[model samples]
Target: MKGFVTAGTLALAFVPGLASAAEPVCLTQAEATSLVAYALPQAINGTAKRCSAVLPAGAFLRQHGSELATRYAGQKDKYWPQAKPAFIKTLGADGGDAANLTRSLPDDSLRQLADVFVEGLVSQRIALKSCDKLDLAIDLLSPLPPENTAGLIALTMEVASTAEPQVGKIALCKG
Candidate 1:
């Protein structure tokens, strides 16, 4: 959060007053959901009919969509501390376990942001098999901000190579 930024492509390149001086603002679970909702539609074509066909935005996403989309679109590489508030709020009590599980994994947002980035993929029959896995895109290469991107990629590669999913596995990250 303290250092001068290394600029990258993604949304951060165009957003002003961010990526330097401090870490990017982290997206809340609600925000992530909303932004993912927002991003999902754009990422996938003809998907809106399905989402709208479903349960709707639910309560959290509907109320927080605009602000969440702004923060998510604005800050992708925010520092851990900066990202913490939103993560905690989003994950609630479940966060402690997830954070602890991947504490030593990596510094990038991959382990955390991956799910956020690609949750919508689960809805798609094709994206899931095409590019949803950690090996395909990796976290750093993902559209997310930089702080966690590189580290997340490393973690994903490690996980993909070493671990095998047994149960219903959902890696939690914000894409």
Candidate 2:
């Protein structure tokens, strides 16, 4: 479970933006949850791809990664409106004026860019040894609705943020 949480935290690291000297931007729970929901599929797919060599043939990620991703992808359109502004704000905060260029892109284009970025980040961050654990975690959580799975990740992050002293570049607002 801790491994799962760690994986989720890593996946979210880019979503909220990297730590910086700038003051942190805030995301309401709904915004955070929506972003999680929007990102979950990409995260899973990225991890699965990165872990493919080490994971067993029948591992959940190996076997069901695409299916799980597709399931969550279905919910993305519903989550996108709330997620977009939060995403843009974090990007702008992290990248300064250069990030403002993203504002001009159509919603579809921005979504595609965000999706590719997340997939690459998740793929890059996952350690090889954690593959099996991540596979198991996704399998267990697969039964839940995407929103519930996202909520769980968001809530876990909230609890974790409060327990630590170091503030991130983006903070999830408490309900």
Among all candidates shown, the one with the greatest lDDT: 2
Whole-model lDDT, candidate 2? 0.74
Q: What C-alpha lDDT do the candidate models reach, one value each?
A: 0.31, 0.74
Candidate 2 clashing pairs?
A: none
Which regions of candidate 1 deviate over 4 angstroms?
1-74, 78-81, 93-99, 109-118, 121-175
29-61 per-residue lDDT for model 1 (tens digits): 333333333332223222221133332344223
The TM-score, computed over Cα atoms with residue i paired to residue i, of candidate 2 is 0.83
What lDDT is reached at residue 57 by model 1?
Answer: 48
lDDT (10s digit) by residue, model 2, range 1-175: 4664564554354253533326666678888788878888888888888899999898998889999999889989999998888777656544656676787788999999889977887788667877777777778888999899888876766655555444344467756
Q: What is the C-alpha RMSD of each candidate to the true structure, in Å?
A: 17.8, 3.1
RMSD of 2: 3.1
